[model samples]
Target: MTPEARKNAVRWSVFALVGAVITVSLLFGGVSDFHPTAVVRKVYDEVEALPDGSPILISSDFDPGSEAELKPMMDAVLEQCWRKNLRVIVMTICSPNSPELADSIVRASADAHGKVYGTDYAVFGYLAGGSAPILALGQDWHAVYKTDRGGTPCRDLPAMKGISKLTDFPLCLEISAVSTIDYWILAGNAKYGLKLGLGVTAVMATDYYQYLATRQVVGIIGGVSGASQYESMTRQDALRKARETKEAGDLASARMPTQSAIHVTIILLVVLGNILYFAGKRKEKASP
Candidate 1:
């Protein structure tokens, strides 16, 4: 075949393969279920083990750009926290959009778990000054966030009582798509000896694994696949508690089938391309 025709053939093959993969994924769902990774399982186990009414801080630092990937993890974590009856304290410093997103996710999860606002959980909204705010929080949370997201005084909120600093909480969880986790590590963990866990984008996952290895981060949940694993674990926990499966739905699991299909298709294409390249090279050498 002519060079142009060969290129065209490869292009068309890729298109067909991608289309078929999408179709199958949409119709049949993801090809396989993912077992929970050790890191993800550790996060679940830590949250599960927290005593009732234990206060935990959550830093949600991503906007809509990462909602699809990080939101499910946040939701699953929130569900786990609320189910265990832990007091959740939420805050954000990455962007102005973050606080609202964090608030909505926390509220939705709180409502689902029959948790009360200002008592079981309190949102501090968006604090300014980037890492400075985190530092301030570590020093004095009441000074950093004098009021809840709704303008209610932090002193007035029952959940905020006795939570005067970052070290006051036994566990601090951060679901971040940016370098904010680094700030948390520096200010909260390194400085104040705060126990930290993280949920990060796939790209950022490797960046933070070193922290996990060093024991700075107690555990981690990385990307959508990580989220799916945590969701599965949470679902099982819910089942054991209620004696039946909960219908809260798993968004990460729903997206996995499509991701798995595309990944397999791409792998097949790579294998085919290599085989064709070798075959063409042999044919050229034989054309005496």
Candidate 2:
């Protein structure tokens, strides 16, 4: 076969192997003895420890661009919250389109868990004006979020009960792919003392360790890999849905094998390409 065709065959074979790994990982959960990160476990433990009927806020501050990474985290955490019977108030502050993107996931989880709207959960939707709105949440949530996404008055919704300001909620997790977490850290955690946790894209995750160390962030779950770890802990401690497609942890863990496989494949292909190029040049020099 031509060198090009032979290389193509090898590449396709690697891809097929990756596909097999993904299938097996999805069928059975990822890498055995997958140790859950301490930070992720901390978040899971904190959520599990909350009182059955207490409220928590989840702010999804990313648009569709971050859906792959943040959606699984959101799903896993929401499932945990639902299992614990904690009230959830979800909102977004980054993109105008972020609210609807997150709402579908929330609704799906609510449906899966038999959670009711206005009672068990509420979507405050997107709040504009950047950090100002977040600061307003600190001052008076009722003032800023006068109503939920459905236009029902905030005062009328059971979800908002006992939540006068941002600090009233014991924990607020900011899931973002943007700088919105900075605003939450400043306005919500630093100023109002809202107990904060975070979920961020992989690249953005390292930036928040200082916040975690300072206790500004209760814990931080970063990217799909982090979601995979969080999923493990959730399954072991709070709830376990064995191979359940709808369960976020299972869904997230399924993606990890695929991601790791693809990454390894790319690195191998790059190395192979360089080796082939250098070998070809050596052959040419020897012959000519």
Candidate 3:
């Protein structure tokens, strides 16, 4: 056979093998449950179990570039808060881009949970000056967020009616791609006594963990996996609350199969690529 034919055969064999592996993985690993899906779920569950009408402040401090790691976690936490009928105040620091992205995610999740704006949730929009605005919020949330995102008076919004300060909120959740979590720890939790739950990318998780371990922050969700874990956990918590608690068992179970399969597939790909490389080297040595 020609060299071209041999190359084609190798390529086809690899493709078929990959397809089979993926199929097997999906069939075996596709189950879902109530355990923590990611680090964010822990954060979400911390707030979800809070009393209804309890104020929760969320500082969504990421831009579109980091949305993949941030958006799902935001969705999970906001969904839980809305379901629990918690009063929410969504804001942003770092980038002007964050507020709009956060607003869209929160609103969509709230709508899914049948929450009403101006009543169940409110957006204070983006605050400027990065850490400076976050610090100011701790000092006086009302001064920082006297109005809703759309310029509506906070006094008129039932959700914001009695929320004059960040301390009034029992929980403060910060979803950050930047290091904005530090500002919350320094200002909000340390100073104003707000409970801090942080959602950050996997790379930033360690930086936040020191605070988490010290009890400076209540909980954290790290990266996409963390977000998925949190979503699964919250889903389980909700399912358990209802009569359909059986689904709760599937959360971690379902995810583990996929995660394991992914690891295996990566290993297999590396092995196959190395084999191809060495085989090519042998052919080169044997050539005329």
Per model, how many backbone clashes are there?
1, 0, 13
Clashing pairs in 1: 30-257
State TM-scores per candidate: 0.87, 0.82, 0.74
lDDT of 3 by residue, 1-288 (tens): 899998899789878876777677756544444356434445766776798878888888999998867776777677677677788888887787777887888887788778888888888777777567766766776777778889898789998767766677788888899977778888777877778888888799888777766788878788766766776655555434422433323233344456667678779889988998999899999998
Q: Between which residue pairs do clashes occur in model 2?
A: none
lDDT of 2 by residue, 1-288 (tens): 998999899889877877776676555544422568888877888888799999999998988888888887888898789888899999999988998988888999899889999999999779888789988888888888888988999999988889898888999889999999999888887788888888999999999998877888888898988887877765453234434333434356767756776777678878987998999999999995
Give me the runs in candidate 3 sitting further than 4 Å from their true place.
Answer: 1-34, 37-45, 236-260, 267-288
Q: What is candidate 1's local distance difference test score?
A: 0.84
The candidate that wins on lDDT is 1
The residue-by-residue lDDT of candidate 1 on 1-288, one tens digit each, is 998998899799889879988887766663234689899998888887888889989999999999989998998888888778899998898898899988888888888778899899998878777679878888888887889889999999999778888889998899999999988899888888988999999899998888877899999999998998887877555434322332335467667878887988899878988998899899999999
Comparing 1 with 3 on lDDT, the higher-scoring candidate is 1
List runs of model 1 lying over 4 Å from the truth: 1-16, 30-33, 237-250, 280-288
1 versus 3: better TM-score goes to: 1
Winner by lDDT between candidate 3 and candidate 2? 2
Error of 3 at 55 (Å): 0.9
| Local distance difference test values of all predictions, in order | 0.84, 0.83, 0.74
